[model samples]
Target: MSSTASTATSPLGSGAPPGTERRWLTLAVLSVSLLLVGLDTTVLNVALPTLVSELGASTSQLQWIVDSYLLMSGSLVLFCGALADRLGRKWVFMAGLALFTAASVAAAYAGSVTALVVARGAMGVGEALIMPATLAIIGHVFPQGAERTKAIGIWSAAVGVGTVIGPMVGGWLLSGFWWGSVFLINLPIGLAGLAAAAFLVPNSRAREARRLDWSGAMLSVAAVASVLWAVIEGPDRGWTSSAVLLSFAAGALLLGAFVTWQRRSAAPMLPLRIFRHRALAVGDVLILAGAFALIGTLFVVVQYLQFVLDYSAGQTGLRLGPAALALLVAGPLAGVLLPRVGLRTVAAAGLALLLASAAVLGTTSPGDGYGRVLTAMVLLGAGAGFVITSTSDAIVGSLPDRDLGVGSATNTASIQLGAATGVAVSGSLLSDHYRSALAADPHSSDLPPDLLSSAQESLGTALAVARHLPGEAGPTFADAARGAFVDGLGPAMTTGVGVTALGIVAALVFAPSRTASAPRDKDAS
Candidate 1:
């Protein structure tokens, strides 16, 4: 639908209206929406094993369970963001909440993996709408100052809170109920967000309401989805496979076309000039690097806890509390310090700490004490908290008010891509190294080729296979597999160390010394 051009008399005027004090209340309501989106990202992780058993889901199907949501959300975020700017942020946000709520109900009642995947894709559409709107509303409500910084900080903290509680809540629910309980929990929160947002979030839109960039939006979605599809499929299909290579080639061409179209278009959805700003450019890089490390670590470590340490889902969730607590404290603290210290200093410090954590994690072994791992996890969390908050402040604070929706979408998309790349790279490395370790073992020579192939596929499969082996062979095979898995972690984490090291240099060289002023467009909110 075409948006009406906003005028001074329109409720869509850019300024915070007379009741500016209600901004905090608006923030609270917006955060509720954000929390639900963030929680869904991780909550289903702990239930994957259950899903596999109950639904008889294959490996590819399991991957789809997660990727469907990310692919849709990440690909369409830019388009949805522009929709918010044109139509109205409040209208888009409420529509998103209603869609998300309905999708959650469908997901909870899904009878098969195919149905669940469809529901997840629907949820992603809702999430794309909600994410950019929340950030844009915060930018409008807080204006430019310490208050804006703090509000962004709170938003960052809410994500951290969601990350921590997702597994714990999933575990608790799964203990007594079925796997669907996790998705069912989102229902009430979505309803609450819809109700509160109507009363709290003010209607606002770009004053000019430029024509929609339909071609650019389609190309952007195609480029992002193609690249992400390659990343998700690359490890399993072999990086050099024809399909993977073709996907990468398609993504590159589409991306080039997108940039060219944006430069030439009369009205662009994302202005190419924004990348010229040091803060926006560097902040995005930092956010991407932090997400790569954080998600990659969680991907491997959760398996280590469950398969290697023999911890149950509940135990693994509980063990992650220290890291969550550290993140909870560090997010707000980083925001408070951003204006006092420069972005360069704050971001550099965060990267340095993250590099240290990666180095420590690389040194872990199968027999290492829990205390050491916990310490490393906490350090990782603290470093991530600092980087995420500071980078978000830099990105949002640097953009013009009119660009807020698409700009926020850009930030969110970078995060989703970083996460996809991290898991794929780390998983591939772990698989390669573990198989190599097993092949070189003298004991592995006794196993049949088929059993060996099964063991090489995944740690879970190896453990399952070991249990059925003859007598002493079972324990011996289990020990060798666990040891090989630990050996693989070292190489996997080495990649993280390199990624974070690059982030440190980027922060020092490219990030602005101080937060830049918001853009000076006449209609800027």
Candidate 2:
């Protein structure tokens, strides 16, 4: 039960000798898996319009396309992570990759919205398996502390690369091909990974006596999925509807039960005891908040670029180039800086930058130039980069030496949760405010009755139709829709500012300044 950080500084490896060509080959396989997952998260966004046009997906179906993936991926990751620990990392990861690849093919060929939704959900299940399995393997393979940090830094950089490149790749595919091409893109990547992994990666078996928390896992999934569903459906169902209220009630009750059950269960899916450490708790909270703000806004921004600014898919991809470049530069710098500045200082700087970036974004209106957009995007990338890299280090460092699987599970789950919640929260705000704004506008009369009904739908869906309107009515409709979209962005930014500000205060009040060295005597188990 030695402190993970202290022992982690030394070689605590579970695999082959460091610097072997085989080791890097193993990393390459895992990196591809990571790239696919990250790419899939934002990739389909540029293709959403194409999806709607080709498949005739309604507003609710469009939301489902996105939300289904997040819900399953986010909610099931902890269970999947633990399952890998009890099983084997490489096998589970390979399985996840295979399943994900197959699902992509299915999604690509899906004729109906329902089939795509189901395929995407299946893809999420695969992603849940891959993410934690990869992290756990990193813990196993890179024994030496500095090498592990470097390895994970590369992993982190890919995450940034994935975030940046997803849009570009999706856009490129969509411009020449179709919406389904985005899903098809993953097939080659997955096949290459499978080929590499079979030769390069060493398998690690789960220790015996690790208990499965089936009931807790079910409840956790039910709770998170229900909550997300409620938020996504609130517009269609009416915010005050009986079903929405019931979903909320059920989610809250189940989550509460899950927490209570964790306190009593001998084996918990998520160990609440981990949060007793200040560094781990604060780091996790900031990671969650940062993930939400970054992901949620990205969803909205692509719509803004395409529907409001009239950028083509390829053009939209190019517009976002600055954010990716900023992250590529910032990620390595974070790896070098985090250990020196210490977690608290590094995290605070990140949160402050995030607050400033989000605040600036709150001011973005129609006709705002690319220069202003790039300025805010850079800050957002840097801030999110710090939180993700340093905080992941901190979370992993907090675990005991033997429970790297559990540690990875915790970290992975937190991120997914943050991502899901970010989409849910901001998406809810975006749709609600957009609808309200359009409904209240005096210019509503100018739009055809059917078109006006469409405008009151989800912000992204509304924006798409406005951009595609018939005749001279198109320009005015686009203008009104862009105003509502901006109207939504301001509130979303305000929410981000408030959330990040709270994170800053939380770090000051709670995060520890001690070296990341894990304490041996304090290991609870």
Best by lDDT: 1
| lDDT of candidate 2 over 128-216, digit per residue (tens) | 88887887777666654566666777777776678667888888888888788899988898998998888877676444425879988
Where model 2 places Cα greater than 4 Å from the true spot, the runs are: 1-22, 58-60, 206-209, 446-448, 458-471, 519-525
lDDT of 1 by residue, 263-336 (tens): 99888877778787678888989988887777667666777777788877777777777777888888999998
**Candidate 2 residue-wise lDDT at 388:** 75
Question: Candidate 2: deviation at residue 415, Å?
Answer: 1.4
TM-score of each: 0.91, 0.91
Compared with the true structure, model 2 gives a TM-score of 0.91
Query: Which runs in model 1 stand beyond 4 Å of their true positions?
Result: 1-19, 56-63, 111-114, 439-442, 519-525
RMSD of 1: 3.7
Residue 293 C-alpha lDDT in model 1: 79
